[model samples]
Target: MVVAEVPKLASAAEYFFKMGVEGKRFRPTVILLMASALNVNISKPAPEGVVDMFSTELRTRLQSIAEITEMIHVASLLHDDVLDDADTRRGIGSLNLVMGNKISVLAGDFLLSRACITLASLKNTEVVSLIATAVEHLVTGETMQMSSSAEQRRSMDYYLQKTYYKTASLISNSCKSIALLTGQTAEVAMLAYEYGKNLGLAFQLIDDVLDFTGTSSSLGKGSLSDIRHGIVTAPILYAMEEFPELQSVVDRGLDNPHNVDLALEYLGKSHGIQRTRELAAKHASLASAAIDSFPENNDEDVQRSRRALIELTHRVINRTK
Candidate 1:
């Protein structure tokens, strides 16, 4: 297999480094850093006896998987910006915006190559196969979304399934990778994977709610991309189901920017946004329940990660535009 070019970390890396660098968010940055560090190896102590009990071999496997997964994820974002023609992300200019789309797409491709190379190095054919499948699902999700137009936003089945592939599958894969590294039972891996899948659904629901509610200032992208792109996310899809009439506005042929605002209003009238949040919360609850399968000792960090993950999940819902 061809190797991917590693991203040049020179000047461009500085911008990513600056995130949460100042003021009150400094602590948030530290927490993010700590989590990143933990991905490689648990530092600082694992809360009482947790450290002594963790299998070092399993931890190493988890670290390698995480690093590979993260590189793939970051690369995908770069490519996604180009496809979406998105200018902003993570509250700043997108990679395409900064480096130009041609270079950005190359960078994304490079990251994917890097991830695959890392996957191959693991020497575990099962994991390499799983990662490859996950990447294919991601591409499928992107294609499905592209086919949507105001004329046809797709059905609830399509929407949820697309959401699973686009947003949740990678996370679920990450959990499964964890189990594989730990030499856990297949039942354990499947349970963790299912938990991740549910968590991802909740995560996407919150994202859909955010598009309407979050500020352009906070969210980076223009809040109405979902409607404009003809992609009906959970909130709007729920609206379409509840008030069938709203479908007309969503399906309005090649809706220009002029009508996007009006379409949003119609969706709002159906109370789809609120309903979406309720659904996301239900999924989050399921993810939390999945923690029962984890060993009692090492669970606190993972559980705290779950709680923080839940908080971020809710933030996606309440975000105001």
Candidate 2:
């Protein structure tokens, strides 16, 4: 019943200006703003004696984990730009494009060093092992993606599995860390992991959809990079089934000899985009459902913040920017 709006983050360029950087290495600089915002939310206090009782033995441990997590996230952006062969990230030139791959690689390594240092300082053997395992999964996911074959590309399951390991693993790991840090029960941790895993899957799928459907200018990169890159996004994948005749055309690249009008016609007639949005919404709701085990209170703002988190999920799917 509450009519609400998603928060508007400043454009990536605006974010850089806000962060006070102007160099060509604006991708990392811009990501730093978003990373900082994400970390700030993770660092927030829960409630009153919630901290005292909740602090337990994991307080410092969680702090170190959070720092390391942020470092890794920051590092990954530098690596992602190189992998994507992207010139611009976050509406600014990618670090590799601006500073050369060597410097960009070194910078990314430095961030990894920071991640390790913080993790070591956490002094939790189990947590370190968990993170190390997550990294392994990350590498495996990347390897699978790099080695993708034409036959693999033909299957939707391939992409979904790739996304699960590549994107969802780290997200799920983060939730596990949080649950462990908070001394939550195994049941609670399971619930949290389901939320994170589903959220991550939805996030990546919608990202692929947006590559075809979004305004490139708002997305900060040219749209349809997915098509140009030969990656079949969810919309196109779904549309292929709905508009069977478009298959041969899609194989040749979304270029379609028939041109834009035909392309739009197929896209408009297909239910793929609409169904994909529903799928994203379902995951977002599942994410919200994870709150069931959390200590609930009558504080309206806490509820609002929780709702805001879910809204943020929807925003990522719906946003043009």
Candidate 3:
């Protein structure tokens, strides 16, 4: 369904959409799992004249929602690669690198328009509102990073807030949407949102750690690229806590090759990587607790789903790429 939405233009847009189709598809997978778990009691009969919980219609709608989530995520990646001037994504040449910025940006816009169309077709106002808010958060987060003041860039609180907007908002809201579609209570939906939010934070924290520790080949992109781009990620932020001298280097825009080397040296010597791992672990724990806190029900399927979600939290913290 997602691939069909992309026009068969004899241009780079088709390539961009094909590349998107080959992604890990992590966002949609999570949505499907959450939907399955939330609606575990499918054996229960619906009220007369109503669709059954496990009916073909319900499953089709859920699949459409999953596709919508993936479309939005891929659209974001397309725009991000252009903004960051990223050369590679998911181990392949970026659309901007292959097609130039104008086409890439327009392709991204095209994908977004398709996603919005799908969202409207769902005809669920609450789900539409949640996803619209996620889009707003994504833009706000990117703007915050691009336009951050010097003092604001150094603040941990500011960094985490930006992280939430950039990484967590989509997953959190999508999880809530899944719960809402199941007609779950407000409290249960919030719990689903909380779980996704913490998991996303942990995922991004690990990604930052990998930036410093993983190889370019392993990461599928240039290592130390964030600092090279004049962006200070979590490791750099924590390293500055121990080596205050690095601030001057950061303030200098890290334009000098020598300063970049010195910054990397400081980060390696400091506890930055370890501390970042600790913080990620903390969020992972919170995510697990969120799943565990879901009200205990006699449905065995629900119990299994909760356990799977908890295990996913661990995987988020421990992923290498």
Candidate 4:
């Protein structure tokens, strides 16, 4: 990985890519798959009729993008763990817990700086802007979550918008960067962005449901952590819709176990979990539809990547962790 190219970042790189303790490299995998799916022969035919959909130069650059996206994602996780005062992640002690918040925060900043260097090396101004905007949205989303009022928390629109900023923006923009780097048209780039946006939303929505349904051991973190943090997610919001009285309990704050239990009881009685799953399913469908809109490709590699991208939506919805 290019992360190892700089000898000075060895420690942070090792932490991010720890052997036998890796989290699912979801963002990089998606970005790489999107790159392959969009590798259509736009300019000219290959010399010997072999399907060389991308030149080595372009492929290397795209790989750099994959690395950059993953770096940014891991950096965000590091910062988020500190912000949430998390104890465990990926079934192990969180970076902040293991190395202290100051070191973890500094490590996150280091990763972001390295990611910027890699991104600037790509030299694609539009792609640079797209990715930079995603970073900006990350801060915006975090602030929105931290400062949301009672009324704002209850509004479905507000929740969805914040969800997009926090979770979907990076995925959507990165996917579009993949398309743009491959010289795709504006129409094709939008399709890529739409697919990423929907897939990301579905992924996060399922995460919200899993926090309720999954055990701490299976989830690699405490169940009901969101409620304990007083962060209302889709399931809780939907429950509030069905049972208005639950809002009073939420408004009272979930800082205490009593209110958390009450909220969970109301959620269990309502169709909140089911409804949240349904919403995730809807976004998964939309993501698949976006892939369907891509131009037809006869190349085997392109076709395989396209199918995998569509299949990914289903996996994101059905995954237990």
Error of 3 at 285 (Å): 0.9
Candidate 2 lDDT trough over 10 residues, lowest sum: 1-10
Candidate 2 local accuracy as lDDT? Answer: 0.61
Q: In candidate 3, which residue pairs get closer than 3 Å at backbone N, Cα or C atoms, i.e. clash? A: none
> lDDT scores for all predictions?
0.65, 0.61, 0.82, 0.87
How well does model 4 score by local distance difference test?
0.87
Residue pairs with backbone atoms closer than 3 Å in model 2 (clashes): none
Off by over 4 Å in 3: 3-17, 20-22, 40-54
Backbone steric clashes in candidate 1, count:
9
lDDT of candidate 2 at residue 268, scale 0 to 100: 77
Tell me, by lDDT, which candidate is best. 4
Each model's TM-score, in the order given? 0.80, 0.74, 0.91, 0.93
- Superposition error at 44 for model 2 (Å): 7.2
Which candidate, 2 or 3, has the higher lDDT?
3
- Candidate 4 regions exceeding 4 Å error are 1-9, 19-22, 40-54
> For candidate 2, lDDT tens digit of each residue in 298-321?
555545555555555666566554
Estimate the lDDT of model 3: 0.82
Of the two candidates 2 and 3, the one with more favorable TM-score, higher being better, is: 3
